[model samples]
Structures are given as structure tokens and as C-alpha cells.
Target: MKTCKEKALEWGISDRSVNNMCKTGKIPGVMKEKGVWKIPDDASRPVDKRVTSGKYIKRELQEEIKPLPIGISDYVRAQSEYYYVDKTLLIKEFLDQKPLVSLFTRPRRFGKTLNMDMLRVFFEISEENTAKYFVDKKIWRCGAEYRAHQGKYPVIFLTFKDVKFDTWEATLDKIRGLLQEEYGRHRELLTSDRLVEYEKEYFLKILNGNAGEVELTASLERLSKMLCTYYNRAPIIIIDEYDTPIQEGYSKDFYEEIIGFMRNFFSGAFKDNKNLSYGFLTGILRIAQESIFSGLNNLTVNSVMDEEYDNYFGFTETEVQALLEYYKVSEKKKELREWYDGYLFGNEDIYNPWSVINYISRGCIPQAYWVNTGKNEILEDVLKIATDDITEKLYSLLQGEKVVARIDQNVVYRSIAEDPANIYSLLLVAGYLKTPKKELQMDGSYLCEVSIPNREIAAVYKTEILSHLLQIGAITRTTANKIAESLFANDHSKLQKAIGEYMDKSISFYDAGAEGFYHGLVLGLIALMDNQYKITSNRESGDGRYDISMFPREARYPGIIMELKWQKDMDIESLDVLADEALDQIDDRRYDADMKNDGMKDILKFGIAFSGKRVSVKTNR
Candidate 1:
């Protein structure tokens, strides 16, 4: 055995590194004597991992991939600690077009916050010269004209991402706290001779966080002036997720109060402030111009349909392909595309960045990562008061059908529930729907043919619609569970009784047609067992099209086939006879033949008859 110093000399590394390895047990068969490490002569060098070299360790270990970043918006940490997809070029694109005030509206978790941070780091005139963060990134090669803007201006970056609150008072308090924090970053200005006495008083009030409502309302405009005084240059402003508070206010009962304050608050800083060089804002929806950007004429809004900066927010196919190739999971690309791809930003195809990172970092198991982040409050709210026609359209979307509507990109939140097209517009901007094809009408309106973007978003609609049914008492979890249990146990009477009761409660939307309504009801009920059953509908099997088929992904569970007939003229007494005839039709058509071919040994068939709110069920095993 030898001291760590001897091993360091032999391995041509620092003695401290060897001592650290010994202390952390990375070096095997080493012991400590007194205050020093004694290393075994036969100890081979462990691979150095102290510095990230754009390559991870071998894929055979328990942690084959680097840790996935969650809720991390710092560009430096994200690039250093994890496998980062380079979105730094977003900075270059912003510099190239340098809009006076640019507002980008994209759904949450689409790298908006992180991209904002990248802009702050690139543009803020700091003494540290943070160009090291973008050393080898794509933005570094966009030519010197673009690179010259790096660290060239004073920047005031603030994110209203967490300003969502249930009350106006609480929301105001949070904004005051954020302003105080930003002021603390420049507290050194308090002693500068450049600041006049009155300006100093206002700065001190904001810095101490004891400002009145009037002062707090004008905080951003005041801070911009102060920053200009201190730096001798106007500062660029970046506000991220700017509409979170407005959306929350509308959901809660304080929309007018919040809007009144915000209209003045934004107009003060952005409308005609000479201290402001430019501004940037990002959110999920563009609250109407008259509502928020009341008098800001220089503002530019780039929504999902805009061609400028289309590839900046989400992952393009080329970017996703590069990431998959780096992780050596190229074969999983098709599955990832099916789940996370299909978002259309401008004319470019985009994938959800959050879902893609999680899928690769979690061993490539495809899941609805983006959908499970937060409650779909906005979507549920829209569904609560949706008209019958809108409800039918939602059901069609779940069935992989396309919905066409004239979408107004600038949404008026207060009046969204009044128009069905507004609901489709909300879903489109909120990242739930995507247009695979569109046409420009002669009247200057876009005829967009939209559908659920991908499987992940489809799962979101399924979960939310199921919850809506439960909330309205159209169905109950106990009844759903009972149905699954009875189907598995071949308890025909119990399952039949539950279906009749559920149908009776869910008959309000039958104007679309009895067959379609009953079909949607049964489909929603079966979706509850989606984990165990791969349910399909209106597909060719044997010699005819079956209404619904629940084929167990696991062969252990029995296959289920359901046939339904709606009678407009039958009395309640003859419903049983109609149900028996439906059963005979299922047998005559050999609906079970497909299940048999698929190697399902146990099969259960159900025939259901519906008349108004009454239902009859008969089964064969």
C-alpha cells in the first residue's frame, strides 16, 4: 500500500482527487491512516467523471442516462448538469429581429422560462461576462453582429409564473415581493450620486417593500428609470408567463379587479416609457389587446400560427433526432413521435420538449408527462358550460375525429364560454389541439381542421371528460368498478342493472341521436379500465362492424364485445325483446371471430337496447 500522494504521481492526477476517491469509496481496497489516505498498489484508476464532457457514462449501469431536469429554468445549470437540447439559438433569433416589444404565447412547460433566462444572460451587461455559458452553443456561430449583443445591455428579468392566487389582495402582495427582490439585486444604487433625492425615496420604498398601492402599481416603470440612471443605458425587460395572474383571476371571481390594475400597471412600464429599450412577454394565451395591451402600440404578438420563431419553443424533428441518436435510443423515435409529436407551430412540426426529456431520461418509457403536470383547470371550466353541440364535438375528438372551427388567436377570456369556436380556439392555443391541415378561405379566415395533437393530449381529454361525467353524477366510480368486476366475473345481471341506471342519468344529450349518445356513454364507461383493456369502436371484425370491443391487452382478462340498438317506437315492455334480437345479431355476425383469431380464449358478448332513457342488457359467454 502507498499514500494517496504516491498514487497521484503514478496516475498523473492531483493528490486531492485520489484522496477524494478514497474518502468516497470510489477507490477500492484503500484505507485511512491518521489524517492521510493509504491506497493499494494494485488499484486501477476509475474513470474520471468530475467534469461533464458532453458524454455520459456507459449505458450498462443502473443510471445509464444523466438526471432529467425538472422545473429548472437556469440556462447555466441546465447545460452543465443534464443532457440539454440547445435552445440558445432563441437568443440569436430575438437579436436578429429585435422587435420593440415581443410577446410569445405558448403552452406551459415549453421551455419559455428557460429561454427567457437565456435571453437575460445574453443581454444583461454584467461584469462577469457570462459569454462562457454560450461558449459552444449554436448562438455563438450566428456571426459577430449577433454575438456582439452578448452582455451589452442592462436587463430587468421577472417571471409572473407563480403569481396565480385566489384573491386580489394575495396577488398584489406577491407582486410587491417580486419587485422588492428585483430591487435588492441593484441595492448598490442607493449610494450612487447618480440617483436624485426623489428617485432615491421611491427606490428605498420599493427596496424595503413598504410601498403603497400607487407606488407598487408603478413599480416596473419606476424601476426601469432607476436602472437607466444607474447603468447610463436603458434596460431590456423580460416578463415570463405574464398572463398567469389574469387567467387565475378570471377563474376565481376577481377578473375585473385584476384587469383594472394590470391595464394601468402594464401601460405605465411598456406604453410610452422612455427608460425601456424593449420588452418580452410569454404566456399560454394572448389576452385580447384591448384587455391587457391597452395602449402599447409597439407590441408584437407571435402566437402558434406565426411563422417567425416557430422552431424556437418546441423541439423540431431534427433536434429530437439528434437527441435520440445521442442517447442511442434511435429505435424508440417512432413511439416518441406517436406520443409527443404532432404539434404544429407555424408550418413546422414540433414535439413537446418536456415530454421528450422525461421519456428519454426515464428509460424511454412513453407516458403523458406533460398532461400530468398541472390540473387542466381552464379546459374543465370550458367543458362545464359547453353546449350540446360542443359536447358532441369533444366526444368526436376523443374518437380521433377532426373538428373544424374559425379560431380567434387573441382570446377574450371573459366571453370564451359564449362561443363554441372560442372553446376550440382555447384548446388550440393551450396545446391540446393541432391542425394537420388548414385552408385560407376567401373571406380571409383560416379554416383549420384540428384534432388532438398526440396520444399524450388524448389521454388528458379522456381523463378530464371522465371526471366531468363523475362530477355531474352521470356516472360513479363505484359503478364503474362494479361494471369491470362483473364483466370479469361474468355477472350479467349486475352489469346490466348498472348500465341501465347510468344510461337513465345520462340521457340529456340525446338530441345528437340515440345511437351516438349511447355509444359515447358506453365508451366513456369502458375508458375507466383503459389500463387493462385496449378498447376500440366501430371497427371491422368478422363480417361486420362492431359497435365496441374491449380486448384485454393481457390475455388473462376476458375479451368483451358490445352491440347496441336504439328503438324510437318500442315500449318499455318490449325493450327486453329488442335486447335479445341485438344479441342474436351479434351471434349471427360472428363478432367474436376476431377475438378468437387474436388468441383470446375467454369471450363475453353483451347486447344493449336503448329507448329514451330506458335501457336493457343481455349477455352471452
Candidate 2:
């Protein structure tokens, strides 16, 4: 007889699959001996007739491919059942540093929770020979010094990723429940003779969900101490998505309540806690001003801007290439890179793991997968408080241009509204923007040239970020559709009316006095046509720079150019003359030279003039 592992090796499948075959009686002579599957050495591998049918050959090909771990966060299951990327080297990195407390800040769905769970599985003491899980992993390939740390300590793991609630009472209740579950994980403490009576009582209070806010605030310190007493070793505490509740608190108007509770709660767990052997935390933002990690002299933060442990959070270039090769879709490399491969984590070029996996699972079709994972509250907030300068810069960004901004890694949520410049910092850490060039200032902040990461983010900017403008009634959908249709059809009259109507409704007198203001307004409106055109702005073509240009993605659409002019206190007659002069300038400067050079035969040029919410448009078709 052969064991499940042996059969898995012979069939080129996972042991879990062989074990499932035994459980389902797919094998002829399988027996359970000592709670382990015993299969005949001569038994043939079972095949699903439905999947193997010639009519379903395509489905069979899919079945032969290992399933992608779309949302699987469990370490053992992900590595064992799915095509797991070997992130076990993260274990090696952590062991080398051995900081007392480490906080990792990354965007959502970048495998933060899964990585934290992996750390827990690697370090937490288990009785079921957990070493087998890592025997074939990268960590085990390292020397004995690293392997010796496997399953060596008690671990207290908590994930506040789902602790979102509108009221403080409800959020606290959810937190208490999470704490109760973590305490229940260590039920052996109840019967340990090493634990004193008082410690056992406190453990029971947490286990039974009878612990109030006060007890829960100090729950981490107390539980770690009791766990140390029981195991005779200090415990590792891991908190995943620690900022979720804090972000919810800020958005739901319970900011003060959550911040106050977290200050004490985190302080008890990480700040100067003797019971903690090592602490690990993962969140989207650092939330430094809240004093959550204050006075933790040993704290080390690995943010998106840091070089240490950068490759572990997101998939590096080599990793994605291997994934593509494994799935037999290696030909999609260029498309995949163009859509999802522009994220910069520290100095490493990274791909969005969430989107890449989803793209592969969906037959390599590309779309904005990451944007739907959560609400874009940060972008919405930025749009809500955007000043005229900020608006113009955002328009420029959408046109595939970079903007210079200060990036402070210690940005807090409360300060976003206090100082709108913090929007750049928030956008960088949240994965919406990437910094290709950064120079460190004396203030410990980076002055970065930031732009949209990839085509996916550009699409997201048009759909998600611009949709906020519609939500706030900045421009009507009718106006947007009118502008898109008019531009596509080369109907200058309808385009003129659409721009006039949008300016009258959305632009204030103070906002229409500058060419930059009108430029931004027109850019936001024309952005609706992005699906059909590759929009660019302020590019040198022919003899000079044109204000805006739309290069058609397909030959069926016409290439477009617009030169905008604005003057203070202009009469209606003068505005008309200004519009005509703008059109004459586009021709005199030969702005159509770019599209012509690109083999475009049909091109349209428009000249738009704006003054105090009044607008005039003229086009040469």
C-alpha cells in the first residue's frame, strides 16, 4: 500500500487531491488505517468523465490547470490547494531583522492578510507536524538557523479588517467578539496549572465574551502574559488591517472614540510590553498622529516607500512571469504588464497581485479588478475638497502627466481635510499613484513626481474618481454624453452648446477667469470620451504646444486638437473674435502635425474661449 503523499507524487497532484479521492471512494482499494489514507500501489488515478469528454475539451484544459487563489487568505489552504507563490522567504527576511514590533502598510488586497497569516503559521506552536507545510518551501531551504525558529512560539492573531460599523458601540462589540475568538483559540490556558487563578479568571472573561471595554483595552497585554505563563515562552502578537476600524471611525464620525480606544489598546499590546516576543501589524495607513504606536522605540515601519520586505507584499516582475509561464498563458505578458504591472513598491517594480490573479482566472481578459474591491473613499474625499489648483493638477495627471508633490509617510486621516496637499501622500500609499522619481527632503519627506500607475488606474480615475463629480452634481450626465457625442461626430455646434451649458452650471465666476480653470473644466468633460481617444495635454506639436489633443485609439475615430484661451472681462463680441483667433492660431502653428505624422487622415481642430462663466467655441472641420 502507498500513502496519499506517494500517490500525489505519482499522479503529479497535491496530497489533498489524493486524500479527497480516498474520502469520496474514487479509489478501488482504499482503507483508513490510524486515521491516514492507505491506497493500493496499483490503483489507477480517477478521472471525471464529464470533464474528460471531447465535447468539453476546453473545460478539461481549465480543470487541468490549478485553481488560482482569488480571495483565499488562509496560508495552509492557499499553498496546498492553489497555485501558491512561495512567499515563505518573507519569513526569512523577518527572522534576519527581528525587530521588536513591525508594521507593514500596503493597499488593500495586496496579500497583506495572507502574508500575516503565513507568519502566524510559520511561528505559532502547533502539534500536528506543521513543519511539513514548509518542508518544500523556500524558508526550509535556508540553513538550520532559520528552520529552528519554526513553530517555536505562541501567537495571538487578530484581524480588524471587518470591524466596520457606524456607531462606536457596535464597533466595540465587534472588536470584543474578535478578541473573544482569539482568546478561545488558546483554550488550553483554561486547564494549565502554570496559570494562576486570577490569570485564568481573566482568560475566561475574554473567552466568554464577558470582557468590557476596559478589559478589552488591556486584553492584548493580559492575554500575552497568560499565554507566556502557560507555554513558558513569550508570544507573538499579529494584528491585520489594524487601521480598518480607525478608517471607519473617521468616515463614520466616531473618530475620537476609536482613536482613544486604539491608543490604549495598541499601547498595551506593543508599547513597552514585556510579554510580547515580537509584534506584527498590517494596515493601509500608519495613523501616526493618533499616537497608536507612540513611544515604541523599537517599532519599524515597512511602507510602500521602503526597500525592506518590498517584494513580499506585492508580486515582483519575475514572480508574475513565472505565474504566466505556469498557467500556459505566457503570451499575455505584454498586455498584462501594460494593464497591471506599473506599481512601484520601493525600488521594485510590482504588479497588483489581486488583479493579475483575477485576470488570469478570467481567461486573461483585462479590466479594472482592484477598483471594485472596496469603496474609494480616499479619492472621493480628495474630489470633495479639491481646490482650483488641485483640480488642474488632477486633470493633468489624467492626461498621462506627472505632478510634483510632497509625500509624507506618516500621513494621518484627520489631516487630509486639514491640509489638502496631503491628498498626494494619501493617493500614493493607497495604490492610486506611483512615484517614479523621488528625492528626500530634510524634513524626512519625499518630493516625488507622481502619475497614474497603469492603464487600469487611468480607467479607474475616469470612472471612479470622475463619478464623484457627478455624484456631487458638478456636471450632468446629459452634458457629458452631449460632449462625447459631439466630439465623436465632429459637430462643432453641439459641442459649443454643451460646453456653454456645462460652464454655466458647474463653473463659478471666480473659477472661469483663468485659462487653467477653463482647461481643467474642458478636460473633465472630454474625459468621458477617453474610451475612444487617448487624451493628452500641453504637448509640443508642429511649431508650438497645443492646449489639448486627442489621438484616436482606432482608425474609425477622428484625431482632435483644441486650443483654449481665457481673458478677464471680455464682451460677447470680443469672446467670438477670441475664439476665431484661437482657431487661427491652431492652424498657423500647425497643431495637426502630430496626428498627421501618426498616419491620421481625418483631424478636427477647435478653439475655445472662456470669460466669467461665458464661453465661445469655433472649430475647423
TM-score of each: 0.78, 0.86
Residues 98-145 of candidate 2: C-alpha lDDT, one tens digit per residue? 999999999999999999999999999998778867776789889899
What is the lDDT for 405 in model 2?
96
Candidate 2: C-alpha RMSD after superposition:
4.5
Candidate 2: what lDDT? 0.87
Candidate 1 Cα errors over 4 Å, as ranges: 1-66, 440-445, 482-498, 504-523, 529-621
Most lDDT-accurate candidate: 2
What is candidate 1's lDDT per residue for 13-72, written digit by digit as tens? 556667778878998888878877887767898886675444443422323344656778
State the displacement of the C-alpha of residue 313, model 1, in Å, after optimal TM-score superposition: 1.0
Clashing pairs in 1: none
The per-model lDDT (C-alpha) reads 0.81, 0.87
Residue 428, candidate 1: C-alpha displacement in angstroms: 1.3
Give me the candidate number with maximum TM-score.
2
Whole-structure CA lDDT of model 1: 0.81
Residue 512 of model 1 has an lDDT of 30
